[model samples]
Target: MPCQSSEELNVLVKEAREFTKDGKVADYIPALGRANPHDLSIAIQYPDGQCISAGDIERKMSLQSISKVISLALVLMDRGPSYVFDRVGMEPTGDPFNSIAKLETSSPAKPLNPMINAGALVVTHMIKGNSIDERFQRLLSFIRELGNDATIQYSEEVAKSEFNTAYLNRSLSYFLKQHHIIQEDVEELIDLYTRQCAIEMNCLELARIGLIFAMDGVDPDSGKQIIPVHIARICKTFMVTCGMYNASGEFAIKIGIPAKSGVSGGIMGAVPGKFGIGIFGPALDEKGNSIAGIKLLELLSKNYQLSMF
Candidate 1:
C-alpha cells in the first residue's frame, strides 16, 4: 500500500477540523470541559514505520475510557481469559456507557462488556496488585511498553476531579459487589478505575499503542509481543462491538475499523498490520464520541483502504 504524503494528510486534517464546529466539548466532566472544542489532530503510523501527522498532534489529553482496552488486556494477561470472562461478559449493550439498567435486570448482573464504565470498573478490580498505586504503576508500565513512550503519567487534576464526581460509577461498583461480581473493596476499585482513565498521552503516543493492536499485539517497529494474540483478538472484537458507547455499530458501518473513543475527545484505531490512526477533537456528538475525530477516521479509512472488514 502506498503511504499518504504529508501534504495530502494535511488537507484531510483541515477538512476534518470543520466537524468540531458542529459538536460541543464534553461538559459533564468539569476537567474535560476546559478543552478547546476546535482542537483537532491526527497521527498515522504505517506498519513499515512511515509516520504522518497534522494539527496539534503533540497536545496531551486524558485517556478516559480508551484505557479500558489496555486494562482489559492487562487483566487477561495476568489471569487468563476464562477468569476475566467469568467476571465480565463479552456482549455489547446498546445503552449508554454508564447505563445500570442491565445490571438490575440481567440475570447474572455481570457487565455486558469491558468498554463501558461499569465493565471497565470490573476489569480494573481484576488487575493484579497489592495497592492502588502498585496497580496503577503496573498499568502505566504496560501502556508505556506498548506505546514505547516512557513519559506517560496520570493527570492528577483529571483523576481527582473524576474521583470527586464519580457518583454513577460508585453506584455501579456497589451494585457489582451486591451481586458478588467485584472481588475488591468498592472504593478501592473505583479509585483504580478513575486513575486508569486519567492516564495522559498525545496522538503520536496513542498511535504507537494502536499499532501494537494493528500488528496483533506485537510492537511492529520492535517486533516485541506486548499482549497475547488471543487477548488482542478479544480486545479488537470488543472495540468493534462496543468501543464507542452506544454508537459502536454506527462507527463500524462508517469507519470499518477496530477502534475506541474516549470522553476526552481521543480515538485509537487499529487497521490490522496496515496502519494505526490516532485522532483528537474535544467536541463530541450526543453519543460521547468525538465528532471531528470520527469524521477524520472515516475519511482516512476510505481513502487508505485501512478497514479490517
Candidate 2:
C-alpha cells in the first residue's frame, strides 16, 4: 500500500536511473558482462497477491549471489541449524564476498559467514542429495516452488561461463576441503554452485519469492509454510548482516529491510509482513550492488517511510 501505483514507482525509477551512469556492469564472468548498464526494473508483490511494477520486469537475469540465501535456507531445512552452523559461522566480514584471507586465519578454518563464497560453497556441499544431478534437481525444484514458476531454469550459457572462470571459488572449495569443512570433490561442488548461481528469473518472479520470505516463509497463495518461521528469521538476519556483501551495513541503515543482492544486479527485498520487492539494474556500483536499484530502494524507503527501523 505504501507504493499505491505503478505511476508513482515509475517516477522513482526514473530518478534513480540517473545513477546507473556512475556504475559498470560486472564483466568478470563473460556472460554477465553483456548486460546493458543502463537497464533498470522493479516489482513489488503484496501478500494479498497484488503486484505493481516499473520498467522491464520480465527480463530474465541470473540470480548470482542472491541464490546463496535460498541455498542456505534449503540447507538449513536439510541438515538443520546445528549441523550447518557448526561448519559455518554466523558473523559478517568486512572483506570482499570472495575473499579467502579470513579463511586462512580463522581459528578452526571455517568461513566467517554463509554469504561469502567460502561459506556458500560449504552450504551447497551440505545440500542433501545422492548425486550431483539429484542434488541440483532438488535445489532447482525448491527455487521453482519459491518463484511459483514451473518454467524457471538455470542459464546454461551463464552457468558455463561462471564455471569456467570460477578459480577463486575452486580455491575456496579446496581450502574448505583441506579443513574437512567440505568433503566432496571440488569440481563437483563447483559445478553445482555455479549452476546454482546461474539460476535465472525476472523481477516479478523474484518478487514473489521475496513475498514468501516477507511472510515468514509462507506461500501467500497456498497458505503453506515452505520454510519454518525460525528458519525464515535466520535467513532474514543474514540478509541484514551480510546480504549486500561488504556494503550490507550501509544498505541496512539506508533501506532498513531484509534484502539480498547479486552481482547480476538482482535484489530481492522482504519488507517484513508487508510486501516483497524485486529489482534488477545491471549497472553495478564499486561494491557490486545494483547502482540504480539501490537508489530506487532508497527513494522508496524514504518517500514511503518503508524503513523498519
Question: Highest TM-score, which number?
Answer: 2
lDDT, each prediction? 0.88, 0.94
* Candidate 2 residue spans exceeding 4 A from truth: 1-5
Q: After superposition, how far is residue 172 of candidate 1 from its true place, in Å?
A: 0.5
Residue-level lDDT of model 2, residues 1-309, one tens digit each, is 333349988999999999999999999999999999999999999988889999989899999999999999999999899999999999999999999999999989999999999999999999999999899999999999999999999999999999999999999999999999999899999999999999999999899999999999999999999999999989999999999999999999999999999999999999999999999999999888999999999999999888888
lDDT of 1: 0.88
Candidate 1 lDDT over 1-309, as tens digits, reads: 323447877888789889889899978888999999999888888778888888878899999999999999999999999998888989998999999999998889999899988899989998888899999999999998987788888899898899889999999999999999987887888788888999999988888888888788988877788888989999999999999899998888888899999999999998876777788899999999999899988888799776766
Q: TM-score, each model?
A: 0.97, 0.98
lDDT of 1 at 78: 97
Find the number of clashing residue pairs for candidate 1. Answer: 0
